[model samples]
Target chain A: MSGASTSTAVIDPYAPFSQGKTIQLSSASPFLPRYLASTLPPHTSPSHVYNTRLRGKLLILDNPLRESRSAQLKQERAAKREAEKQRRVQGVMGRREAKRLGVWELRKEDAKWALFLPIHHLWLGYIAELLQLPPPPSDDILHSTDPSKHRLPSVPGTQAKLVKADLHGSILSVKRAKNADLVGRGGIVVHETENTFKVVTAKDELKVLPKRNSVFTLRVPVYAVRPGTGEEDGGPMWEFELYGNQVCFRSSERASRKFKFKETIEL
Target chain B: MFIDLNVPFPEPIVYESQFTPSKKKQKQKPAGLTNAHASTSAMAVVPAHPLERLRVPDRKALRERVEMLIHLGYTIIAFTQSVQSKLDPAAPVNWFDGGEGTVFRDLDPRFNGGKRGVVQLRRLNVVLDEASEKGFGFNAQTTQLLAGYDILSLTPLTTSTFQSACLQHSLPSSSTIHLITAPLLPSPRLPYYMKHTLVRTALKNGARFEICYAGVFGDGARNWWANAREVVRAAAGGRRDGHEGVIFSGGAGRVEHLRAPGDVMNLGTTLGLPHETCHAAISRIPKSLIIRAETRRTYRAILSEPKLVFSAVPAGAAEDGGEQREDGKGVKGLMEILNEEEERSRKRVLEADDAGEGQEGDGEESEPSGRKRRKRRRKNR
Candidate 1:
């Protein structure tokens, strides 16, 4: 008992403070046996501390007898997702800006922006379906003529529907702007306000660009993106410009806005 | 695409006399003389500005002709108004602005009936006779006047007019003259010879020659055969495709003049156009002309429409190569976080397997947190 080295960490169970209580081999803290290290504020995880002093004795980190914290976190996330889905079905989208989503504000992305590519694809399909453009240009010409001349753009009757199409998730670049900083900024539209767009650029930047005095180069694939399959049906890319000043309306208000071909007098 | 680009719209009755005829009658045998003859005989009579205001009888006749075309299975029909009087270039060009609606007001533009609907098209045929050779009002300022027309056809009555119509007015860059029809009704032969160079130049510039089958049944039946054969021979020699750029339309005035498309194609064969080429003239050739003519309103006669779309690659990677150099602190990227999450999940999965023996007996109640619950129960028991 007396030959123990002076430098040795000989924690005594019978010491006055440790008597009738569990040994304090690990540093005392409010949140550890819970191992909720990730739950703490970022950069505040107790990494410098011996991650767990009782890691060997208590076997909490690796033992089969106790539950894994990671599995517990997965359960919590799954539950949250289910609740979100229920809220969506009930028409309780957490915000009025988006028509069909709950607690689903898609403003910025520090990560997971690539995940939005699929959403962008769905937007392309939505437009193609709304426009009802002809079957994407084929390498083979249409040998079988319908012998009908009134297939003017296939159906001129659908012009009204095309004028009021919804433009969510469209990829656009600022072509002209009053402010030079706003020019050349292009992105997938994450959210649209009455007079602005919350865009997540390819650099994963969320820019809230003003709509007035700007011309946006909207890029669209000629063909529709097939749903559920992440591949395109192969068509050339086409670009057209939309005057931002003309489109300064909330997404809901845009459907009711009347568009005309009258020449603009302003430069 | 069975198209009849020229179903002659009825001449509007201008009650005001064009040239009083000096009120001096010869008292000769002919009791029925049309107003046009009196004006032409007066010598000093200036050509009337082709009347546009329609009376009831005139509208009724036009409606009847359009219905006849629809009944005869002509899918697309142009109510062609032949403007014989030269237009004053300085005057307002919207003369035929709402002519189609005025003529077919009660009828729907897409008035569907037997087989399919008759799509109404308004055509403006400017007759370039010797009297108006200086300018038939074809110029930059006349686009407003031509905007109302779905097709612009030219009728060259003189050799000078024919040369201008073929070489100058047929250019795809600036001109809108889609069809060139020589006035074969009164003329013995085309005022100008159908030279191969002129024919090829016009054809190259996307001008189509129209062979009016209605002329064959008119007073000029004899003249129609001679003029049409020359046109077909010259236009066919211009292009490799024997009957390449010739379309058959009816410059029919009376109801009886309108013939079925099959009969018209048969009439084309009479002009020595092959049976296949004749079928194409009424079907394929005219259909293409209609599409070309529709381009007059576009930005620059562009065929494929342009629209906006997303690029295949990410815009940052496409435009700039410095995506990774976006300035910031030691920011955790997406891949790093994702990999860490995956590692933790794998660890949890392994732990579940190790604890599988303890929970296997009554594994049916297995919640992910069941292991902790079971351990607590053992301690209590």
Candidate 2:
């Protein structure tokens, strides 16, 4: 072994084994000379070498100040984050004001606008209401939740058997089975035929026909129904909805609940 | 000027049989500071970062992208589970193939091998819990493992823990959550504890949530969307009055519609749906959609379809705070179903007895004949 290699053998990789404890100590300077001894070898007197190093001498770096690479990176990130925060706050304000001035176009803003545009729309609408901006001429269809009430003539029908019930809707008005009564009623409806029906009550059934003479409730289209399990009795159970004239349907996957519902309604 | 009308149209190139595998595309880091919290190991291995921001889908591009993922270390099963769980946890977490195997032989196919192997599950669970405890916005909840699911919890880990794990040759924090469950929406019919645990780990660590919904138009047209933007937009638009600033779904922004964040015990009353129906809806919607209910705001919705409107009572119409439904609708427990079945059988027996009584013509004589016939049939068997 080289003369230097011979000395390195004395040092321990896992060091500071005291009593029953094993503490890992840095071995970086195990062979490196103390600052006092550059032309000479490091003697057993570490204290003597330390004192000698205090005096002007040919130096050996026993423990150099190592760079904290991660610390520097953290500082840089903090600076960047501060800058970003300022930018986002400014953007929010700018967008809000511009919306107020009625000159804001979604296309002109940066991609961040896409993130904030929906929020901005809501805020601006609120602000406009507070400022008493002349209400943009409102239409019944635009605001009314009961557009069906204005058109549909009440149908004379009884609620069908309740298939399923939730906190929101009940699955009722099921056809194709034997005669059944409205098991119970909070909301009830009757289907006279496949195409003629009324929402006398809010049963979670399909409103087969037009609510009014001309206006029709939306039902999901037939083609949208996913091919069912093909049970011998009935191929599959399908659900439909009519958004005006459009219909939507979904296939059932009872096991995994991966039902595929398709919307036939155009936005 | 005469136009040449008979010019032969160029034949479309038919490249179906000749599959030209494209060059591996570069993996993309999610939007924002992907490095802020990601472990170096995750960054190194999973080049395409999944957690930082929204991933809008390119349907045409999915096949190739998935193929590339297969080329990477991920198993097809992992990929499918990741995608489906992201869409809806209730959806059975399925895969294209059982696992990923190299096209060539002589390769170690398992995730871990002899020497310098990855960390084990027990250690992983410890690390994740420690990290979550140390970090802000990180919380861990331990509960009974749902049947057919893994037993673990999803919790956010600290950045420092992430760094150390990478340096220590342990599994990435992204896969730390062992048993996860998606938030509820649509329907809460299906629950997979093991798949959910994986999803929770991925999400808590940093996986972006995406919903892949196949839809069609009113004209019988079909299309699929890989993101939740369109659904959110439409659902939000349909909200009556003004929205309560937030919407909740199953998980985090993964399904149709949105809901408020936080506990939504009274979502039905807030949304103007019957309480039972609302509860049912919340339970059913998979962990795909993020859900929250307004603290003080209530929105009234007009129920147009009668069948769509559910009654609060289990049996007939009952007042608020009444007994369960009479028809046994929405009864969900082992005991309840067993009781229902017992009741049904007893009803059948009673009906048979009634039929026997109605046949009064020599009923006493008929009973003896029936016994004789049964004995004869048994003997023949």
Among these predicted structures, which one has the highest lDDT? 1
Mind sharing the TM-score for model 2?
0.16
Model 1: residues >4 Å from true position, as ranges?
A1-267, B13-52, B90-95, B99-116, B237-239, B303-381
Clashing pairs in 1: A147-B1, A218-B308, A219-B308, A219-B309, A219-B310, A220-B308, A220-B309, B112-B117
| Model 1 CAPRI rating | incorrect
Give per-residue CA lDDT, model 1, range B10-85, as digits (tens).
Answer: 6543322332442322232133433554444434433333333444566567667778887887766777877764
lDDT of 1 at B81: 74
What is the C-alpha lDDT profile of model 2 across B276-314, one tens digit per residue? Answer: 333333332211111000000101101112222122222
Cα lDDT over the full model 1:
0.62
Q: Rate the local accuracy (lDDT) of all candidates.
A: 0.62, 0.26
- TM-score for the first chain in candidate 2 comes to 0.14
DockQ-based class of model 2: incorrect
Q: Which ranges in model 2 have alpha carbons more than 4 Å from their true place?
A: A1-194, A197-267, B1-22, B25-281, B284-381
